[model samples]
Target: MSDALVILGAAGIVIPVFARFRITPVIGFILVGLLVGPYGLGRMVYNHEWLTWVTITDPERLAPFAEFGIVLLLFTIGLELSFNRLWTMRKLVFGLGALELLVISTLLGASLSMLGQYWTGALGLGLALALSSTALVLPIAGTHTPVGRAALSMLLFEDIAIVPIIFILGALAPYADAEGLDGLFDTLWLGAVVVIGMMVIGRFALPRLFAQAAQTKSPELFLAASLLVVIGASLATGVVGLSPIVGALVAGLLIAETEYHSEVEGIMEPFKGLALGIFLITVGMGIDLTMIWANLGTITAAVVGVLLLKAVVTGVLLRLMGARRSTATETGILMASPSETTLIVLAAATDALLIQPGTAQFWQIVTAIGLTITPLLAMLGRNLGRRVEPVPEIEEPESGEPPVIIVGCGRVGRLVAQMLTRHGKPYIAVDSDADMIETCKREGYRAVFGNAARMDALDKLGVDRAPAVILTMDEPVLAQRITRKLRAAYPHLPIIARARDSLHAAELYRAGASTAVPETLESSLQLSEAVLVDLGVPMGPVIASIHEKRDEYRERIREGGALEHKPKLRTSTAESAAVQAG
Candidate 1:
């Protein structure tokens, strides 16, 4: 079939089916690819010309689409981060990430050598396997969550380390040691030049380019400009012997520095999602189930062994870096699978004669299987993490009054606790940040260091018996997760949630929160009240006006919340009166 038709078919079918099951579309796209891939239906029906449209005949034709998908994914990641945030994470990215890679590679390489593989070949394999799938993990974990940020830092460092690893492999090539060393240095210098050049050009040029596109008031033009920036930067970095993703990431970072980032991001979302699905499909295409079945026992053992080893190593490193136990465990398991870059590194090693072709092929299959099941592993990690680091339950509050439970003890939570104290209300605060909890204690607030999402922590706060639960965390996704869980466990318990905006308030309401307070709405109301009072309006009248407006906005939020929970395309039945009469 035509490429466009196939793409439309995949997107139309995979996304909704997966969403219905509350599963990630990553798994769905991969499944669809497996169904039509060469080793599946494609290999079975080459002789039937009329049935050709049912399968993907030439996977090579779709290769560029998959690569561009990864580029777009990295670009969006860059857009999400500022240089300041990236700077703050330099230690984690370099210190923890570097150590994770080095330790895993050394241990794996040593083990492979002991197993009778040549030392050089083992080392190459070790380096390759040490890497994890950035494309798969990033979307699943997100970069804003504690686990997401940690995984991102490590993945960023891994992407940077890929070029050097490939260079070292080249140096191992027969009779090319000196040339490879010289080439490596040249490539590094060129990479430095490329990064600096892109930053300089992007800083000056991207704004002007986007501004012109904006003046046209055309989405097509804006989209064209965004793609141009992504592809151009990717090509520039590729020419310097670095991965194209690095270039795409740099482009996103530079564009983020401009005021046009939001517009650019909005325009790019559909392309990014579609492209990412294509990449996942390519991963599915690489799987040869026949080979897997032939070596089922060995492959399963290898998958199990590699997963356990990486999870232990990574989880340990995260704990040492001060990550909470659950966060570390979840992040480690999410990162256990080998990466797409592992394939590239293995191929390079084979070309350099450091590993035999058959050996490379065997590991390539491992990497593909790892990629295929990455979503399942993420789910498993999340479940296991919850069980392992269940929250500590507090038997009773010091004040002996039923307390409102606050999930986060940051600035917001502290303020809420202080307000509750002033009103003779007992409260307990929980936070993941140990230092924050300590500061709260020093300031005479009752705060505990724990992940509030854990049920034990909530139980300690007497969530079941508390008059109400207050969610004050600024992390919206985490807040929603907690709210959903709490709502499920305590159907009648009132949940007062703090939302980032009106939209968030609506979402919280859908999650069964009793009241979702939007900060923006409250701030606006406060400002309006102050203005009316300044204009010589009576205090009572000003307060009344503010209350009316607030209620109006809230009613809308309630309506929106009701809409979100309503089933789509609900059918009306005409037999209700007859049934009642019967």
Candidate 2:
């Protein structure tokens, strides 16, 4: 109970404090672990009894929970991906990812052998260091951008290869045993059978199970079912001598194929986060500061050497595979560090007698340090990528018309693009939806697929050079966020945003939107105009009155948003004037 209090306290302090300063909570949690782990405050608890209340007296007890955190992390990652997306990335996963692991492992292993270690031990070390942290890297890069996609491909392959790697390590054990190879083959066959069975059964069973849970109309039951599925899948794989995370990931993929995925994801989000935090904390607890201090020079050299080699190798492979130089550089650097799985492989090597316990401990410390610096490495990679590729190439329309950027390719955005076309203005639409992009392309519309919420995507779309940006997505919060981000980044860029209502319009105005067109306001004005026209009012007078009313309402909205009215000439104003004159 005291330990639980300590963990909760750490979370309460770490999340808000780090978030307030715009820092990642990963670092904060790790720092908290270092502070309260047995080697830190717990070290003094024996002499000072009061310290026992705050410190984690037995870090080993937290291991199960930490492992579960990793399971949940993989599960959530699976939820974000579909089978088609995975299949599309097969080349990257198998070709680039496989080559990267093999090359790094071979190079690191040969280097270790040259330094006088046994061939088996060196091989174990090489394979262990070749792995990169899926937990740390994925959340930071996300599976959206070029860097993120490249990283995910490699990480996915790594996850798949982990079982084989462990079995190979066992085969390398000094013990004279043909059964080791036999066991490896047996496990592989069993794992394959189990995985296929789960896929076939889960495809048919999951939707019905979730439906029953949904029918209960109980969130607690839904959550319970989600947990049950994750746990059951994890246990099934673990029982079959495969990585439990493999099962968790498969379960997530299965759930993702169903309609309840979003709800399942939402309900499991908090648990996943807390579990990942626990995993990170365990990583920190493993760090023995005194040991690191004693072996500082050697550990630093090893970490640097490993990072440099992995980064260069991974970057070259990506470049060879036809990735952008910037993407290659960023992904390589982002994936340079050894993974959380490095600890697992190291422990496995030690258990198999392929490496000594002391050696395993040393490498574990290095892995912890590497994980701690992952976020910093990510920031560096991003900055370097920006420097390398200062200006992104923009895809322009064939007509060479001035580019008007439409952030969504939805109904409103399509109408806006059509109007722009009629006015002889060239426009490009960007949407996150692949289907929408495909439809737009089929209709001969210049549309690109990307999440505009990300600044990098906007930059790639030439947002800086565009005449104006139109936010047509129905998400009010997202629209406002994009408006604020764009306004801050490009102070002079005109931002026109769609709002749900007058109140939302006012909010958008405050968020720096140049114009916030509220659907409710426009629909009301159209209705009023129609009623007046049907009641026998002159067309010219009614049109003029409607224009006058729209302007009045816009000014009022601007006032409500606490902004001074700034009159600006608009194309609509000129059209209204022409109508009034006629």
Q: What C-alpha lDDT values do all the predictions have?
A: 0.85, 0.89
Q: lDDT at 294 for candidate 2? A: 93
lDDT of 2 by residue, 132-235 (tens): 99999999999987888999999999999999998899888888388888888898899999999999999999999999999999999999999999999999
Q: How accurate is candidate 2 locally (lDDT)?
A: 0.89
Q: Report residue 213 deviation for candidate 2 (angstroms).
A: 0.7
How does candidate 2 fare on TM-score? Answer: 0.77
Instruction: Write down the worst ten-residue block by lDDT for model 1.
Output: 566-575
lDDT per residue as tens, model 1, 457-565:
8887678899988888888888888889999998999888889877888888788887777887767666776677689997666655665666676667768788543
Give the Å error, residue 89, model 2. 1.7
